[model samples]
Target chain A: MDDDGRDRPPVPTGRSERARTAALEAALALAVELPYPQVTMEAIAARAGVGKATLYRRWRHRGALLVDAVAHRNARAAVGDGRIPDTGDLQADLSAVLRAVVDELAVPAWDALLRALCVEALVDTAVGAQVLEEVFAPQITLFARRFAAARATGHIDGSVGDVEAFELFVAPLFHRWQLRTGALDHAYADAVVRRGCRALSP
Target chain B: MDDDGRDRPPVPTGRSERARTAALEAALALAVELPYPQVTMEAIAARAGVGKATLYRRWRHRGALLVDAVAHRNARAAVGDGRIPDTGDLQADLSAVLRAVVDELAVPAWDALLRALCVEALVDTAVGAQVLEEVFAPQITLFARRFAAARATGHIDGSVGDVEAFELFVAPLFHRWQLRTGALDHAYADAVVRRGCRALSP
Candidate 1:
């Protein structure tokens, strides 16, 4: 719903598309330049040269807008597609996907932006919910699908539930990255895949 | 080191010890009551009824003081002893330890305080380093030690390194809790232990 609650779509025009693009771009840039909490709607409007009303019409609040902004960035970067390659080799496929994650996180700008979003999500429950829904769920669901297919094909043990399988494959990287406890590299990612397979494969 | 670069211990009188206790308690309370970045030294001093000079004399900055406050709370609660019960049943012991973590995180004040500390650690590299050293390293090291012992006893596969072993046993819970991705309960904790032991045990 837009700010006015009319539930109308974004004005579909070349100009409207440009403004939306500019607004999301500005939100991403400002999020990186300032602390996430301090990146206000007004600043995003000014940076994007869009009226506050227009920005609000598109997004309900800062959280909503920033969600779109980060999602936009991720889409542009071709990350979080939620589809693992299925060459009938589960470990090799998982390793490739996790290595891609390592590569994405290694980029400094991407790291800072994600860390900022993570800080915001940690503090605010509503934002956290939105992030879980829009950002993480798609990827999680797709990964679960891949796991189910693997189980059906006898690539993994059928006893492991989807949730456990997903956590087993991915949680180690998320844990290490969040805590800054160790290096997040291809080797660690491959180790996770190897361990996960040993635990799950038939 | 103290703020003045003098390496003196806190005054060892009974009165000084009481003051120190009051300060740490105040820091913990204020950290829960306020946003972490806004919880300043002066504010902690005022809340504790200790002079600001005395607070600084014992600790270098807000991060250092807050770390002590959190560690004190954990110690009083007996949370992070870094010792897992060696009942020769690795899965049961891991389940017991992880369930304790889940219980600790279930407390509202403890959750809020640790989340606040996590936010600060995420934003500041110096604070991050200190947190890793004082708050997380001990737990990780002790867990690693337990894994090594388990390996030597032939409880777990010897091929898994300490790093992979530790991550396998602990990282899933940390991942779920940090992301608020699912229910953090005894059942989930037990599931993680089951999966981990299956992955690691000979």
Candidate 2:
């Protein structure tokens, strides 16, 4: 059984899977176009070229549909490669990842979708927890692993735990993005990594 | 000539000033009691023991009322005492302020209200910008000033600029608080300041 709670189907994919994907894509597109409250089941079904009954059969309500749509969209970018790029220099690899995040936030659609999802999550606790777990937690774990690896290699100070070090590096990026205080750029990433590395120096 | 833009009736002391303070307090109290959507002019007025007409006389609507409430609630605590406590040690001062922030977050009503305001701000750009300016910007400026003072006193590396250093030190705290990832505690604060100070070392 896969993590999503169903066994992997054999090859020769059927129309049902295609329809499900289409429905999610349509829901995501609609979420971007309209506010969370306005993204109705009927609209999603119509956009997906499926019937309202079909959408209802799968999702109990608009919030559930939005949740599934966001989850599906986030799964595509789920961070998996566990290696922390121990090229004898921890700072360089960390800088590379932080810079990538800055670039990712520059994409308008990603920022819009994230902001919308955050707003919805604020109102709905369950949805917020699910997003933190499925969408945000995975990325955090990846960074934690890297930090742990750096600690093992003595590239980082032994006293600094994985979680603390990870927060030190990534928290700043999210803070800047969420608050819109300043630009998240390569220069900022470099400063964070350099400062973080120095802090961890034994 | 009060900060709220309301004409003062020159009350040397007594009921009118108290009434104004009570109205703002009621607005803040109502935000925690009900979500921003459920809060209304009538509810705030009733909570404040003032008439709806009185609330309208002061604030045009619920948005204005809530904005003023948030502004009043956070004003004093957010701004440092125009000094960064330069005890000839950069790390200690930074850690002290960061720890205070952790204590601030532990106040249950504060976090919930901040989340609500942030969510509303996303949807309403004007309110969002105003909150950032009136609330968050001043705090960031204070940290920047501290960094400048630290640099001038030779405690920190003069090479690091004020804004960059400020982001390095403060972003992580806001990031952790806003995301609800981990505990914002003294240990984490100390680590952040220690690491940041080291990185900024000339």
Interface RMSD of each: 1.3, 2.0
Candidate 2 displacement at residue B28 in angstroms: 1.6
lDDT (Cα, tens digit) per residue for candidate 1, span B94-201: 888889989988988778778777777788878777677666665666677778778889888888777678788778887777777789999999988887888886
Docking quality of model 2: it rates as medium
Q: List the residue pairs that clash in candidate 2.
A: A199-B195
- Taking all chains together, each candidate's TM-score versus the true structure is 0.86, 0.81
Instruction: Assess each model's interface with DockQ, reporting 2 decimals per model.
Output: 0.61, 0.54
Question: Alpha-carbon error at B16 in model 2, in Å?
Answer: 9.4
Q: Candidate 2: global Cα-lDDT?
A: 0.72
lDDT of each: 0.78, 0.72
Q: Give Cα distance to truth, residue B175, candidate 2, Å.
A: 2.3
The reply for model 1, stretches above 4 Å from the true place, is: A1-18, A30-40, B1-18, B30-40, B58-60
Write candidate 2's Cα lDDT for B27-118 as tens digits. Answer: 88887777667778888778889888877886666766676677666553443435567677778888888888788778777777777777
Per-residue CA lDDT of model 1 for A1-202, tens digit only, reads 1253112223436887878888989998887788666789999999999999999998888877877777666545544533678888889998998999899889787787788777777888777776776667656776887898898898898877776788897899987887777889999999899889988868
